[model samples]
Target: MAYQLRGGGGVAPDLNPLPPEGGEQAPPPAAEVDRISSLPEKARLRILSFLPLKAAVKLGMVSNRWSHLVNTPQWPCDSILAIHIRPATQGPCGCLVPTHIRSDQIMPLLANELGRRGRGPGHRLLRFFLKVDDAQTRPADFYSLLDYAADCDVEDFYVDAGLGPPEVSFNFQRASHRLLRLVLFGVGVNQAHRRPMSQERSINTLEVITIENTSLGDLELKWVLLLCPRLRTLVLRNCRVLTCVDVTAASERLVRLTVAECPQVDKISVSAALGLHSFRYIGDLLRSVALPPTCFGDLRICFTKATLVDPIQYHNWLDALPNLSNLVNLTICSNALKIMSALRNRENFQTQVAKLSNLQNLRELRLVLYRMNTLMLSHTYGFLRMCRCSRLRNLFLELPKARTDSFVDAVNGLAEEPAMDGFESLVKVKINNFQWQCIEIELVHFLFRKARSLQKLILVAPKGTNPERDQSGNAIFPDLNLLCLEKAPANVEVQGAQLVLWL
Candidate 1:
């Protein structure tokens, strides 16, 4: 979820207005300009807090009193790093925040400021954000801030710096102990700088860290592993530039780790499963990846391509997780079926998906087959025969391009197996992005007959190129408690109950 702006709906906070000081100052408009200084104290603080860290401090010119408040320990501080822009045909209306602090200014400010105010409840600030606005951030500025944060025992450092090639490349050993959260977005560091980061943290002091599109070498990551002993949450996205990650700490306190869009992470050996319970790995090539025998509990993996070199490699990787038999929720997606048709690997590969039948604690399963030959879904019934999950109840499948006959055969095969049952207990089934093929309708009919325990069925309408090309229709669902159809009429009670319709 995107963080809501302080004012909601990403609306910017209001700022104080000022009259021009130069001789070129133009005449004022008829309406009065309400300056921030005129606002009440609490309101004024809120307004300043809403301002990006850079702009907030530049407002020292608002008044000397305001300058003191800007540096007060009660307020929040962030790096003025990010920049966003929007344009119009007429012109551009942009919001630019520039910071002017350098190493010299920040050092004294910390030594003097913390000396007077001190830490504790009085120092209990909400969050510390690192801005990356180029307006006034110099390379030296961050080094000083890094050192200052180390000395001050700062925690919760949030960084969004588009730093110069090597703006900040130091480590935090002792001083970084109190740090809890580290959020890095588009923040790059000098990987060549193998210089040891003297800063090493405790076994579990690090609570959570998020990184996106940032390039950090394995050495640096391993450095963090040694320092951040008590890592609870780690999220890495689009960091495919990294090929090696030392997850040696997976055996202790780490609870959740999510990695996505990292194409380079082919081998994931969880040597030390730690306190890990939730693990999600989604990337380009999942076939070659490895998972340790320790990884267990809630796990999710997705693949839209069949480029998996060895299909069984993934199953072997899954087997490595100790508690695989007890997975609560499992989701598998493959969009490569279309490409697989030409290769003839579909028949052999079907066994790979069925191998997931061993997940005993699996209660909910969502399978998405994108633009792949949906007919291959028939192979899933064999999986049903192998599955021993008695608690399975909810099933959701998305076959946007599945051939109609294949869909029908899949359901029919499942129903034919008497011992392979979920009929009376299965409550929900959803099929999205339906193709208008005849087999698609047949599949729906087959589901109505096979799923006696089904309470709800949803058929999502296929998209139309233009609004004019859309079709208006409703689908029949006999013996079902609820049916949801798209691009149809209202909730007309056709038979037993009114099926929900969306246009």
Candidate 2:
């Protein structure tokens, strides 16, 4: 957290007062205008600090002395560098008119001031927040200004711009060593820059990077992998257009990678990402890439739409995970389950589970029933019950968004798993949006009869239901003393279950 900002919209309240030169409160005796104009140079700098990054730098025009101080060399390691266009000056309402400056004049002026200070230290956070409201906001203008920051070694660069000429790129001479979180909007990576991108550079200190709402036309993603060797987390959301992507040798040192909402990335090329710890992807795994992945930590995939999936066809992915034994927690969502559904028989299902069954260390199993329709939820739950995960101690069931249902049938299916004779290690169960039909009640009762070590049962119930109704003698689970009903109304009558557990 480079620096905390006040007010949510990236600007402080009391816009007219003019910020002091630093971060502190000024005394009242100084009076308004007197305090602002008469304050010591450093004090004025403190006041200016309160102004948003844009307004603060603009203060150079207020006075020659102000510009001198604004140009002072210091490591601005935590300033959000906003580049959104607005009228030359703010309006009367104190709210800036959303209108952007048309000419490319502001960049040269602003860049001259900051660059005159000349490549000081890397600002721990430099956000280039641009709003693409018109065709006039050239990508070159934005890129040149960002080029200045990349030269200065900005750590966090967020670019929300428009699609300009296809021939565009930022060739950082030394490669940004501190660049961490990089977000883009309405831009594309040209093929011309692909090779230089693959050329190894020193992005040794980078972390989380995201590319959003844009098209990565011919951008070789491998550059991000090879060049940014220390990167641990990445996200590319809504980048709807991409043709070729090769990320084979790119996985040197990454812990988390998230690729959601990117409709066009045709294929994912990876041989074995040795250090990859977690992965979240929505697109199909292109046959070009070997599977039975080597990612030893966690894998999460979100396939919101229905698609044909065959996990066994890519058995190489499963086999590639030499350390599948090290793979502990597995969350299979829409796309993943779709692939698993392609299996023809229990033998195939057992083969799939067998790869991970050696993970005796596995403890938590989360099943997201594409709870779209009642039938879908039933089938999902039925498919899950077929697997024998003796080590599972916790289970989570998620419902599809908007396809609302209190899935009592699915809950019953879980309790019906024939293996429920007595799970010695099993202790807890959590159901999100839990609806209690007789199936749910019987499931609860069944847990009491089966899980000898069972201790907690959590349910999310409908709003306004009095939990006191659940304390009846008819309720089972004499051992079920801890009932955590999250986000319902205030709970009462936990006494009977407690008394029974003690008895």
Candidate 3:
């Protein structure tokens, strides 16, 4: 049978074959017809709906008929448009070569696509994302896209300017009411543009707002919260210019607030946020934090490198511990415990530990360590003793790579210490970046003696470490005799890289 290329680059048996022996060609057999191309238009659209916009666009290269079908007014893809402007590549001579999609062309291209979709009830855009790597991207271009998105009634919008020069300033007063989520990176929020909106005209539909690496201030953030009466989550990160985040007027619907790496932010005040359940801060200790007496169920505090050297900062962090009595889950760094141990006054150290014991509701605790030293085991034991161990169910400890000499010293130093009380209610414990060293073995033995209720213990090897063999094909497993597996409780199960003990 002869074949011919079909509209979608598929082969089909020829229906009209050349006559043989001068006889009229038999009527084309009904069973040898193309089936997919003959499918109903709605069915074809349903097939296209399952594909992404890029895949659907590739169909236009198949054939003219398929191209027309893909570009029809009823294009099946959800109304999502994303354009990422790639950075220039280095040429052989060390010169920079621009990418195919120039930054300047983005505005016109977005306008054309949005224009083709038209505007109105059924034509609303579900989401639009734009990221420009070029530092020369014009501020007008960003504002134009924002205006177009508002005109098109886009629901979710994300714009990342790559922390370029001359940050793009956003005016939320004109935001679309249909906007549900907005994420801006390296974009500024102009305080002058934040005018009070009428009660009926506010963006009550906005639920989540995240701004990072910008110059957002306390008043501006408060203004944003006031403008969005129904906002639920707000995250501000790397905003160096932010001096304070006062959410005292935050809406009752606000549930989570995160402020990370904002070095200049010295205070966070939350008073009447009834729905707030989680709060996270990552940076130097704040001068003051006025949290509600209750309602927060989860809290996380991670100190930056500067906190380790600044005694006053870590002391401020220790001072804030007693206020978090309502937290059900808490995540902190080992540096806090190390700092607590530095206090020369025994009375002050005990007072700090007594304050930490107020976390009676803490069920899950995560400790991130920056580095390991001989004193770490003692600091860890002191921290665990301060927490309500009978109520703590999950414990996660992330260890850092350490020198062999340091590990040896730690093992020897802790070998003579008395065994601590066991965790009665702890069910699971995970240790990350576990290197099979003397100190690690000693720590495992300490946990075996303690954590009597531990049902599962997981030790994850450091990233890039070989499980079976070293790079030279030598076996990487340590001497199994050193593990002392007999110390593990009968009810406990140990799991790790290629090593699982049922004991």
Tell me the deviation in Å of residue 210 in model 2.
2.8
TM-score of 3: 0.70
Error of 1 at 293 (Å): 3.0
- Model 3, CA-based lDDT: 0.67
lDDT for each residue of candidate 3 in 1-503, tens digit (9 for 90 to 100): 55676656455787676887768555545555445556677766665554444455676677465577766546444465565654445122332222235565766766676567676545655566777677776777667767777776777788888644365777786677688889989888866534444532568788889999888877777778777888888999999788988876564887999999998998877656767888888887677876655646788887766346745455655544435567788888776767765752456556655666677667899988876666777777766765554577888888875544453475457734433433777787778777655566567767767777777766776545544443346554455433233333544553334233223
Candidate with best TM-score? 3
- Each prediction's TM-score against the native? 0.58, 0.59, 0.70
Q: Rank the candidates by lDDT, best first.
A: 3, 1, 2
lDDT of 1: 0.53
User: Is candidate 1 or 3 superior in lDDT?
Assistant: 3
In model 2, the number of clashes is 20
- List candidate 1 stretches off by more than 4 Å: 1-121, 130-157, 161-177, 189-204, 286-290, 304-315, 318-323, 335-355, 398-420, 430-447, 458-503
Provide backbone clash counts, one per model: 28, 20, 0
| Candidate 2 C-alpha error for residue 263, in Å | 3.2
lDDT of each: 0.53, 0.53, 0.67
Worst 10 residues of 1 by lDDT: 79-88
Q: RMSD of candidate 2 to the true fold?
A: 13.4
**Candidate order by decreasing TM-score:** 3, 2, 1
How well does candidate 1 score on lDDT at residue 191?
A: 49
lDDT of 2 at 146: 65
